[model samples]
Target chain A: MSNGARNPNRWLAFSASIAVVALTAACSSGGTTASPDTGTGDGGSDGDVVLEFAQWWEPELPDGVLRGLMDEFEAENPGITVELLSGPYASTKEQVVAGAASGTMSDVVGLDGAWVSDFVQQGAIADLSALMDDAGYDQTQLASQVQLDGSTYMVPVVNFAYMLFSNDAMLADAGVDVPSTRSEFADAAAALTSGNTTGWILPLSLEAPNGIQNDVMSWVWASGGSMLDNGQPDVTNDDVKSAVEFIVDLDSAGVIAPGAATLKEQDKVEEFTNGRVGMMISSLAHINTIRESNPDLEFTISALPAADGYSGERGTPYASWGIGVAENSEHKAEAWKLIDFLMSESSNAQLADAANAFPGNTTARPEFVDNDPIFQEAFDVWQAGYPANEFVGLPVAEQLMRDFSEQLQRVLAGEISVDEALENAQAAWTDEF
Target chain B: MTATLTPEVEAADRQPTPPSSRVRLRRLWDRLTPFGFLSPTLILLIILMVTPIAMVVGYSLMDRVITAPESNFVGFENYVEVLTDPVFATAVKNTIYFAGVSVVAHFVLGMGFALMLNSPILSHRLKAVFRTIYILPWLFTIAIVAVLWRMLLSPNGIVNYLVTTFGFTESSVEWLSDPNLALHAVTFINIWSGYPFFMISLLAGLQGIPRDLYEAARIDRAGPIKQFLHVTLPQLKPIVISMALLDFIWTTQQFALIWMTTGGGPINRTEMVSTYTYKLAFATYDFSVASAAAVIVLVLSMVLAFFYVRHQKSRD
Candidate 1:
């Protein structure tokens, strides 16, 4: 055959190849393209302003509660519409970080205290102090604001404290009351240990190493101990070392849960819900989850036990659902208006009630606390102790936690002494700073 | 037409005609047709692979990136930092162990299963059931495999329950937690999930083996073992080498399974190069160092690919 006779076949092959390439590219692109409605608030039809609010709290709260609040905000402010972009915490963090890096962050964002410093360093989030002032917001009403270099980048909208949760039936079965001191706590934990049950469940997984900040550091914070001295890592200080040693002692006593090195927070909660553990240091945010998972499980919430003979005011470890306006947002005013509404006393109270958390406004109190005895107890614990979390606003906070957790695991495994572990962690943290 | 031409006339006739633009264009088109066919793939490779690799190399030589607005060029400092880090060293060692053990185990398990499936004594229906059962692990996504293995290997999970029930130990075994067992446990899971690919390939190879060779061996009074050692192995040698090399390359770059299961934890006991690079980039926001680690991993992967290509070429 002449070469010209084969041209159609060659053309067919070329077209087929091109089509495959196009199809592959389309498939691999996936869901990365943003829809016009969700696109970073470039004004909707007919001069209406669209503000994208990205957060992780929507999934945690009762379904449609956040959307209802946003609808209310839109009703009050006619020209502004709020869009909710929500996902699980990790994915939200990833999306926000990617957005920040690409200069396409949403108008408003939910902030974690651990992420605040990094965002501030990247200039990803707006300085809310000026925005609040410009909007005539009552700054004094805010319970707390995460600040870096004296500029408030994020304001807490709701708060959840990490407290000691005890399975009441297990404690009663073991004939141990809620322990309020270190020695008593250790004794109670040991007494509660039996077949298929441990006294305490510690999730030390390096994947989500906040277990170190929440579970291990809660011991230090309870007695007003600090992992930082003047904004620098002081992890090798006596208080931190002592806390590590205490955890090692508990591990030695076999009261801490097995497989802790791989267990995550959800796993700890599951063990507690399944009645496999007697106690756990858990967030108040998990209260509803625990109840939903095991309605019959009787549990009590209380302030973590302090070191003996340390009769000073205790510090409760707390995490918050913080709010911030993105630096790249075009509708900053509208974003601030939404933030102001969310931080208002009534709205904050409603949100807190729905989330089973504390209102971020100082004057706001969720009505549920008055009716639920457990919530009342948690409120009392909050009132009696100051919220403390030293890792908050620290640079590379999660990495620091991972470093400390790795060293702590080494100590627990008897590969290193407590002192050595602390020193190693200190060295690792020092490099980060 | 039969009249003889002078030398000058023949030379003039032999001289090429001054072609029209259409003819010249067709000639050019002919020359460009092959490149036209290859253009789509070349463009995709340049965009998807080459660009990203070049960017990573550039980032590796910078002081900071992504998180920092202003990044400074630093000559090989990030590489020096990563190479000197003790965790990086541990990651390299663990990656070698994890991949090496996984590849070897995959080959053994795959060969055993393939042999069973290819056995003449096995009924067709029974062989089909066995094949399905053996390939079930490979059907699961990496995420599902990680989660399933995590549940099975938990201290309070079924595996531990069985171990304790059988009086193997007085208490639950921490398969994924204990530093001593975590690397091996994850490697075992990798092996379980990976062997099916090799099994399928080897089964095809086994089926393609000529019956004449086995009959010849039998004529020579060869036993089953001797036939397998001689005719079967010789027939499967090229495929075996190719599959093993490819599996080794893929296994060494494993990230999802390790990330979902262990996160390279228990004091870096299970840390691999992928996890190390991930943590540097995402956890610490140290893109520069992460890029350096990534480039190192890329180089290692390229070396493995090199061996694979060389083997395939030699076989061809």
Candidate 2:
């Protein structure tokens, strides 16, 4: 910081600090559920305890409904007021990393179950075993949420299982019945497949392409393939390769979208919603968003289209979101209170009413499943035992997903073979790891 | 200066102590005040700019998160990995292409607008009205700009609607979906949002030029194109060059608009250096590699700047 260069940056930092302070105040004000007792006969201006909550569900969720709940929680507690901070899903990992390093983490955080390992590795999150016990949450369910290191950092909220959804009218219009077996599925897809319509729409957008992969797993598991063998990376495994080859051949058959390689994530949603496609391997959670977009469209939900080499046991990963306490929080007790409330039956029911999500608690799942037809199918998938194993490779895994997608795009664009694309994914994952 | 006329009698003994010492002290104060005034700013800059940059540079050289706190220092491993990576190479090429093409297009369109507004044939009132309207896009916050563009360029958006109505195309084009078109689509918005700054600047530059220079040129048989090449361009040189520099930097690091509209997709054919760096650092949390990418950005920008400044020096 020489004399000449120092001044401009100083101004930028000062301005940034002032802006952050103002933003903090604005954020804090939004969560002020007025405490009934704090307003009178108290020496303190506001409650001394300031609870903190962090979540990665913003932008997707409707504006601040969860925050409103927190405010009410605060108002109910005379000596406590909760403050909520939000980060987008993509940045949630980084926020925790940076926030932890800088000692600025909120008292409580919301995270995806897949990220539990990374958080544990970095020591960025804390074990919530005691936190769960205090609330009387189920231990087996809590253990399922724990990382490989045996620490339960996540208080699981939303339970997501991917399922195959069909545009029933489109299939009827195309004179094709909903397919059950691999052969039937292929035939049905071929009949409906056209320039304007693909037999199926699945996003191959390498990053967060989990929904499509989850559906694709139907064939993989059906073909007796496994993504990993006994909780280990197994890219070179025979069953996995055979399963991948099935999709590759279908890709060659032109049953998917022409621009599938270049399609945006939202494009897939629109394709399904706008009746441009007949089937999509999508989330049961997205049913409401799609249904709301086109209420008149008749749709169906079913288990993954059956494939050859069927194994009765399904292979899947839990795509769950959870809540946790921030390690450095000054108001840990209050945060725990809010977490407990949100975990309770009433709050869980409210959450189900607000959005379509399977609550992770065995007791709460019934409330969430009753709301939508698609979610019922999701529950069936869960019953079929398509267990979502812990996400392997972590930070490297995300990079690999992106890299794999880019290579897949090339294949989709007619620039390469599917075999080569898989090879590239292997290489990319190896290099990253 | 004889000691107040020998004190005019003893009553005028102390005539403010011959004020020259005060004057010298005042001169010293004047010379040093700027640094004092600027000290607060300097300290802030060190904390924000210099320190963070240094930290990034250090992290760039490390293997990062693997052995992190205890990891032995490995110089340039991250940089070497990234520079050799095909993904990063594509990102670099795309970023360079974006900066080069957008800056040039901005200059031409901006200069054209400035000339149009400078025209004396238009009434002053009309010019002012058009000027105000032209700057509306520029005044909008970037998020607003992105939302507006998303609507205008969507598969069923207004642009495709207009094209269909005019019979220019048979169907709606997903303008930002095609790999070939996504970069251009993002660039189009960048240009739309950027050109006005250059236009406003060049117009002001045009205002400063003597109107009589054009009059003299006309008398000397110069046409509009000829006058532009000889007179207007020469006079607008400083602003044009400076605007070009600014455009290059701003467009290179652009993220928010692209994030909102595209998310670096259509298979990342829309990838730029800054966005790629962000995805690596924040989205993926690969700190060492992301820090490497950022350091590359800084080095490349500095090199580009050096060349531009050198060219300017040579010209001078």
Candidate 3:
């Protein structure tokens, strides 16, 4: 045998050795577990702390604003440093969920009401009321606390009410007034439907089926009705049935936008921004997005149209930017300080103004409400109608919305009767509970 | 002093002496050489693949995993729950339809385009241009493909405009929202995005086919159709079977495109096993049930893989 054959084997062995070394080096460099004691008392021997604050809020706010706020907090608390880990809402939720499962959650975390119950169940979030008591923070100053089994797990940092948005030009062209009642709203929508445009946009994409909560159930809530009776699924009740019937009627009238079953919230906002739709029920958070997308588009804000002949204070659908302290965090006191700073009247107002939302502190009022008439009108609407979102703090809330949306899609498609659809939804929601 | 060695010493030197320690060590190293080359891959597979799979299997047999502090083994209860759900049934049916139709369409389109690109009459430049256009969809990431198709298939999108302009329809058609059309619409999108992969593979296979065979067929008075049926297909059979099986495995696991476009909506018309499992895990936080569903999907994939391996071995 030639010595060359033996040489090749030697070379192969050498290459394998090099590869093993490289792989070991790479693994050593990349394999970093998030420190369990990241926010603990022993985080630094010098009595300094580094708090990881994971949120979706920073990305949504104007660039540098959230970072600036964190900088201010760090300046005020000399020994404490805050780190911001931010991403879009969906990715943030996924990250937080993974972190919670692994016991590596950020010390201070952004929360959604839908996630509160699950987090509470897992004991992933700390009891905010207890922390507040330890910190001597006034709980009464907070607008609302999301409680699970009488323990506060999340506190609202800001609130965004979903309200009806009407394109002024479209409404004017259709000669329809801003709809205050369901019947008039349908008529206005019908009138607006002409020449490649629809009257209303309802996004019911099951991917993010908050539409069932924000768009469909808003009508039920507007009539001061509940989709739950004593914290159980009441989707088959008269209020929900009426709401579904109203939506089906709209579908039959062809006043609702086409492809609504596949449409998402951003798509609805786009349609409204383009003036392709006459009206939609949307969040106050989208106000700036619309203005940025189409500055020339004239629009007005109003309360969601109430069910006709329901003479009572309407309930407006609202979503919030909620804050919590991770239970795994050893620096619960430090985490609460961050929350307290954010929930302070001035800071909350500043955040709300920048985000075009309502302050979570009861006495805090966003400055945008004074100068922005549309915001003012929305604020007034919010005041007239108490914020109503029954799905909040419910177990598997998003799943509940999805179940309802799936059944509602069937109703809209005329594949099943409204009664049957509601019954099906009720059964599904019951199973989750 | 030139002392002469004794016959006994000479004989001892000639004996094997039970092989030296150095020789034994070399032999042992020779035996372990192949494993040394394979150790990195084996370690990776064990860590990345085997461990996660084992954990998921463990989760499949438990209740309230990942969410609850303490979980109890429920045997196959989670699996039973998932299997009995009507939505799971719908997901299975839809996944079959999606993968079946996608694979068939992908093969047909791919083979057709490959044949066209391989035609001798076409100039090389023309073929290059056509190839670029055909392969464009494959170049895009799945996310981009999904978003592009979404825009094109929107109710008021250009597709609708063209259809209406050509008098194919009276008004804008709801391609994605209509339950009847949504499954077909998404399958069409998948087919569009996936065919390029097959086309590229089959094109290579076509170029590798012996030109002398075709010339011999021509001399034998074999028509183009007969040549294709008798010669072309047989020549590409191995590649075709391999590509189709791989595509089936991939299409069955399609999640991103479906998730981005329809999200298994319009009354569960486009639900696939991937999306259903995802919903169970993420949307409802039912990790136990999701793991069970995942295990079921793994079994199905393993079965497909078994046949694929069998086919490859037969070809070899």
Candidate 4:
């Protein structure tokens, strides 16, 4: 053949090889698929069923109670299988949202407490009132915990409160006592702060909306302010302005960790675990993690305190993670069965103990806490607690919460005054709504 | 020819019998076969690129939320909302600042490294070692780079430790937390991660330059600066412009690095358009607004690319 004909053949071979290499690289780097069965099993026996469950807790507690319950459930109902989907907690919500968009949401999902309403409003989750009644579960008790707008949606798995955790040694070394009021708290924080050690830390980073919402709202709630007055953001309230001013004062006083503005929940816990920080406002879910990391560190817990001259009762932020069925799930029956198993007394007790969290079931809490003095005290404080913030049911809740966080950060950074920050936040809330 | 009138002679005298239609078609097939082999790539590009762009355009005009099935023809309302959002303005401002600083820094640092490596006084062994070292950051995934830098730039981290230990500064710098410094800090990380691409690319461009031009410049009594200006830069202009344009697009769309490090934080000081769109779509489930933002970014990039291509054609 002439060179002209031969050249085309060479180019063809080159292109083919390049295409093959590109495809191979893509396949190698892309995500792994679990099984051919997405929701339902390949046409099996008439009784066969497969249910996909997506939860973030798997990575945190892979071999713990939830896994055990699944095993038990599978054994109890032969020919039924559970497929678990999990990833880093940070990516869980995004993953679920994507799954919803693609119509591949799991039969059941473990959703954040703040996210349940958003999911329900989007029709991503199914109303479980009928399922709850069929299972003989007390809807009134569980529904109040998981329902939105008088409809059952979630079956709570773990209930916990956000409160203050202090490193005892740091406080003792600084000669400060446990604070019970906002003024005393500020004074204690200032007294405890020393060279190379901060007195307090919270996840002030705007990226951690949950952390920012919970930690900042504690101050707001304690000062006779609520994030929502009649389900609308009350950022311009006098009490909220005072709360913002107090936080700004703390930052100006240099009592917060140097990088507090960018810290995440895990970062704050890490600092406390390392025994470098005096105090942290965190949740009970991290107690096991902190203890596991620093076995020798001494720490104490306290109920969130109120602002000076405030007559309101002491309260904390209560939050939970719950299981719910997807609205479009093909295996809704099997999913409900799994949810029933998880919320059962035995499973609740087992999970609460293994996961180091309070049980969602009102009666199960006493058993779950089970004579642990730390949890007993937390339970008492939690009984008076409320939703951390009112953004839970608002439109564009996450963005609203983020905007609130950003304004607060601006105040802390001394770039804006408390009034200006509140005004800006309120403007954003108004625009978004 | 007139004397050779026999059948066999006539057959030889005439042009060899034209190949049958099948043979002619086979030759034509052979000529077109390369493009046939390229069809897979062409199809893949259409599927991944063309389809997504079309979808974004379609979605940008609708009032669609990913979680809900309800949608309506909004017709530019999403775009108006996105443009009017105060946060969107912040995002646009940040993106421009980041892209401007990052691209210029990458070019300067990358060209410097490429020139140093391309120097004749340096032994090939040393040059190879230095080249490898400079390119190492590019080899890492952005996730790894973000996490590494986050740790290094933490208040109590190695960067602070070194500064304080050496008495360079009296206090920790909160590099990722300071409102004024966070955007610059993220830009610095991006510069660190990105300069190596330019280095490798410009180095290849440098190597392709004919030695005669430099020799001629030297003979003309041209100084190092003069030689670089007259010979090196003129040759590198096309490459430099193309790379700079691409870097603008890539840096503006950067997310994982900034997301993992500062998260557009310290009061949205480092909020880029990409992260803002991401937050809108994922956090707020407002896909329509997010799609509008994405379409705007796409148009900006396409406009830059179009100008570059036109310039190149004009030059050619």
Candidate 5:
């Protein structure tokens, strides 16, 4: 054995390597120890019940208003501190999911109504019936939407109902009426479309959660067609077929952009903002965004045009991002207390300010616009609304609807036939459901 | 007084140890030393690499939900689902298409460009500057590149502006929305980011080959093409394979650029396995299904790596 070659340095290398491995494991495992400090409570002894609120992707709500409300809550509670924690938007679900699965859910977490059923099925949520009752909340004031096994899983939050928002100026420029009926709306959209403008900005892509069916539904319900003749895809029915065909016909007649299938949710807003679109159907959530882009521009919100037969038909929107407490929360009393604070008119007002949505609580509506006319108009739409039907909202079902919309776009693009598109879509959904 | 020491001095100088004892000590030392040498790296690998892999495999085996804590076992179903699902199938197809075409392009054009720069007539400083500039894209975040391309490829983009100005067409292209063109657009960005590495590696390989080989070829009346085919290509084979394999794996797992540019939309034409898996796990909150899809992807990746290692071994 050569003296230098057979070295004592070997042990040093071995020990160092072992240390590296140990550290790497510790880092990669993400060291779980009930990350309890995640925004529900202030960790310090300031005599305040510190609560943390988290959201992802910079969901900026009106800060000054929320702070004012939280401050008021703190003043009343004496020793309670409320903190807002912003998390990554996409990964917020991951954290909450991982947390809930581990029985370590935050005191309050924002759950999308779309997956609220799955969450309930997985036993991840608390039934809020007792809490609302205890808090003296008026159940009748709640919107009559979203039936889940004959009970509501969660209450509404800031919402975006699919209403037609158009530049009133643009409509006038196109020589189109404010479309009183379905056929007229199509003709109006057609009359308005030009080289730089699309007539209507109904969702042409399957991926938009605001499904093309709803655009069709605006007509169907307006036209006396049933979405579900009780828990079945009535899309094969003549009313649904005709409504879909009408949309497809609009596209063929050059009302929609040829590249409409790829249009993102943001594009319609751009069209409206740029005054390039005539009349567009979008959620009221975008009112601020469009307003910001063209402040002086005049726009109006209207219900989806009526079908000839039905007296009333409106675009139905599902609720998104409702807050709920953990069923088995260690801080159940504290949690309920916090939830009450949130549900209070002031908190609702803050939420309306932050998320630009209709309030879950009824009295919170007036606080929204500080008595502005625009807020009153929004309040009207909320009154006219129906909760998004939950039975057809199996995540896969929504995905299938999206796939169906793509096929619809294809038919409109003249890439495929209407019958072919529908047939293919039916096959896709049948395979899924 | 001379060179020979006194008996006391000689005895003080050293003692002769037992041969058997010395041998035993040496054996123990050798055994202990190797473990000492390897323990650090072995620990790191086990902790960092192997543990996460094991965890992924464990997660894949379980019926995990997004908001669920305790997970139960579900075997082979993820693989079946991944193999059978249309979205997954499309993802696999697109990933292969992206990697295959991109790597091939990188190999050919990268080597050609590097060779042109490697020429003696080009000043070395200028060549170095060009090389650095070419490699700049590699340093940029995928998001930035996606955004840059988004602006450049939009219907009202500079590239479209240039084309329209040059009378290519009356209207600008809806590049990303067109399924036929979207993958190509993504592929072009990938090539821009990837080719520099191929060029650098091939250039390094080219420099390692003796000028004498070219001289020998010249003596044999070899043309530049013949010389390259015989001398240059053979030497660069190792670099090409390694680069291609690397580019393949990177491109297969590439997510950020595509996700930013398009959410795998326009009928999911751009949906890779990675993005699809992400959407499943994160967006859909179907972690079990996502885990299964991910595990399938992991296995496919391993298979590709295995082929690469085997190829390297065979070549050696």
Candidate 6:
């Protein structure tokens, strides 16, 4: 043998080159070979239609129910297939933004209700009412949430309404009943707060934008202050000012958690479930988790407390996670089929119960309510809840929510007066509009 | 050698024999080969770093709402708006406070650790172990550190548990909540996670310093404190300055730790420039304003770097 053949280094190099080639070959072939049958077709041969549904669920939440729905849909419709793309809820907005920017968005997307109006304004989502009508689906049976400005751009399969959740045991221990008015609520919170526990806790973290918006907006609405009136930012509304004053009072009185401004919804929920919080405004979806966290903890759901001497419907801010077809999608018909299947009376109830939320279909609501006895009151409160599609119709809605959160934090921290904070926030809102 | 020649001709002759054009071309090719090899990376840097920065500068001059389809040129408006915005002022103030305090804390703690680790009494193996242990925090991801610190500082968390258990105070302190303390709490976490980088760098500098200096100091009967002041500090000046400069830059740009923890809240007490810019971009979807803020941050960093480099050269 020649010197090169005898050399171990030469042999090693040859082996490494072979290995690299093999690895490259394997990597290139892996996806197609391993999941040949499960591959997403690009509306090509074999008469296959593949639709990608992007959502924040199917990752952390129990996905068995969603998987069953997809399987049933696929079985019923042999030619069409549904692919689930799951990601963390925190990254939902970013993912959608990037997807839209790159023009590679999923065919069907489960958008946060807050994002729906913005998407509609940007023409990022298609009008789905026509599709719904063509399928002989009664548009009236759809949740009021799906209809924005008398037109439906999405279909909410399930929903979670933000409402007041009280630790009945803690309230009783403090010698206070579930407060139905702002003053009573404040009194209850102040009375209950002692030791390591806070009287009233809501995740006020500006980092958790949705959490802040859901909890804070309920107060403004309950005080009969519309966030936007006639497409104008309305933070200077007297009712909103009073709401800010109430929040500041709560903070100064030390009824709220010490670092409540930095806590997320999950943190606040953890505190509540662990018997540390007396009262909190939370979503109807958390009932099961709260029970699981502490079986002995007695809690009651109630409508948001109205302002004193005010007579209006209680502010129940329920957000529905709805499915919308991307405007740029190629397989719009297939995407609608998947959405239609999920929102079908049968699938809607199952998905809602599985996800621990309310059904968006009116037909499915009764069955879902019947199944979950604990969430019955929450459902009823949500039934009379403020309409979802109204406030967020403005393009400035998100900015308005963000300004409210930041300014509210300032007010709570006593860095600024309620009037000043509200005025500054309103100024920002006005400048933007 | 006897022939008188002009300076240019003489220099050219001394360089080498004037080659044929083909040979000159080959020589030029040889001279340019290394740069030719490096051009790809240079191009990548230009494409990746320079292009984006230029785009940001361009965007700063536009009226770009992130998700909106339309963006008209609005020169200097974004910058004017951002500068006048109270939140931007708060962010700048918070960034300075965070970076200033955290950098000082890191330096002090890092110097202490480095001194201890560099002590002559410890075996090499023991020093290695201690070094590894100290750098553990640096090895952990910022996300993990943020989560860990959050859990520790939570009202019902173990830090409170220990505080109550040890009877340090009757009540549990809200470490990340109080506006007065939230910035400090986040600074403490930043210092804890970051000091290791300084310590390791300073320790390496210490090891490189000759033992003769310390011996010379001892010969003059200089005590430990005096030696540290005169010998150790002077010897470590270059490393200290370099580390301090790097730490200042890193701390100023820090986003995740403060963002994941307080989110510039408790009324924007801990709102750093990075977090504020992120909020403007992602949360508010006002990328033009964010770009303006970013340009300001970039300019501040460049000015600091320029002064640092100039000072370093002056010292040399």
**Which candidate should be chosen as best, given DockQ against the real structure?**
3
The residue-by-residue lDDT of candidate 2 on A1-433, one tens digit each, is 6764766654444444433323322332222222222111112355366665656665566777777777677677777766555657656555555665545666777776555555565556666776666656556533145444565677777665566678898788779887766777777788778756778765654335553345444456544466565554455566656656666667777686544543455667788898877887666667878879999988887666655546466554446667776665655556677777776666665664455666655455555466555666667766776555334325444555566566666665667776776677667656654
Q: Which ranges in model 1 have alpha carbons more than 4 Å from their true place?
A: A1-39, B1-23
Model 6 chain B scores worst on lDDT over the 10 consecutive residues at: B305-314
Question: Candidate 4: which stretches are off by over 4 Å?
Answer: A1-47, A62-64, A140-144, A222-225, A309-313, A365-368, A371-373, A383-389, B1-39, B165-169, B308-316
DockQ, all models? 0.31, 0.22, 0.31, 0.29, 0.20, 0.19
- Residues B1-316 of candidate 2 have per-residue lDDT tens digits of 5555444666666546665988989989999899889889778766756676788788787764532334446798888978997878888888888788889988988888889999988999999998998888789878799878876886556898899889989866768766778889888888888888888899999999998999999999999999999999999887788678757866777777776666676677888887688778755667888888888877665655554554454456
Candidate 4, pairs of clashing residues: none
Tens digits of per-residue lDDT, candidate 1, A1-433, equal 7665756654444444434333333332324333233346777788999999989999987889999999999999999988889888988887888888778888999999999889888888899989988988888998898888888998989989999999999999999999899998999999999988999999999889999999999999998899988899899888888888888999999999999998999999999999999999999988889999999999999889999899998999999899999988988988999999999999999999999999999999999899899999999999998999988899989999999999988988889899999998999999999
Q: Write down the lDDT of every candidate, Cα atoms only.
A: 0.88, 0.67, 0.89, 0.78, 0.67, 0.77
User: What residue pairs clash in candidate 6, if any at all?
Assistant: A161-A318
Tens digits of per-residue lDDT, candidate 5, A1-433, equal: 8654686454444444434333433432322243466533444575556665544413545446656766787787766666754564445665666665666666666655555656675676666776666666566655432435765556655565666676687778877767867788888888778777777766544334445544545666545466555664545667667778888778667776535655656766776788767777666777878778889879887667766655654545434556666654555456566666766676765776677677666677635555656656756765775544433335444455566666765665467776787778766656554
Candidate 4: tens digits of C-alpha lDDT, residues A137-190? 665434235667887787767766678888888888878888878888898889
- Between candidates 2 and 6, the one scoring higher on DockQ is 2
- As a whole number from 0 to 100, the lDDT of residue A323 in candidate 2 is 75
DockQ of 6: 0.19
Interface RMSD of each: 6.2, 8.9, 8.6, 7.0, 7.1, 12.1
Expressed as tens digits, the lDDT of each residue in A1-433 for candidate 3 is 7775757754454444334323322332322234443332336567688898989999899989999888888899889988888878987898888888888888899999999999988889999889988988888888888998888999989999999999999899889899999999989999999988999988999899999889999999999999999999998899988988998998898889899999999999998899889999999999889998899999999998888988899999999999999999989999999999999988888899888999889999889999988989999989987989888899999999999999888888888999899989989988999
- Give a tens-digit lDDT track for model 6, residues A1-433: 8887788654554444333323322332211111122222267477688877778877645747677789999999898877877667766566775565445667888876667776776667778877776776666767654556778886767777777889888888889999989999999999888888888886777677555567766787765566677767787888777777787788888888766767888987888898888888888778878878889998888888988887877666767777888887887777778887887788888888777788877788545577665677777777675643334455545655666677777777667788888888888778766
Q: Which pairs of residues collide in candidate 3?
A: none
Give the lowest summed-lDDT range of ten residues in model 3 chain A.
Answer: A23-32
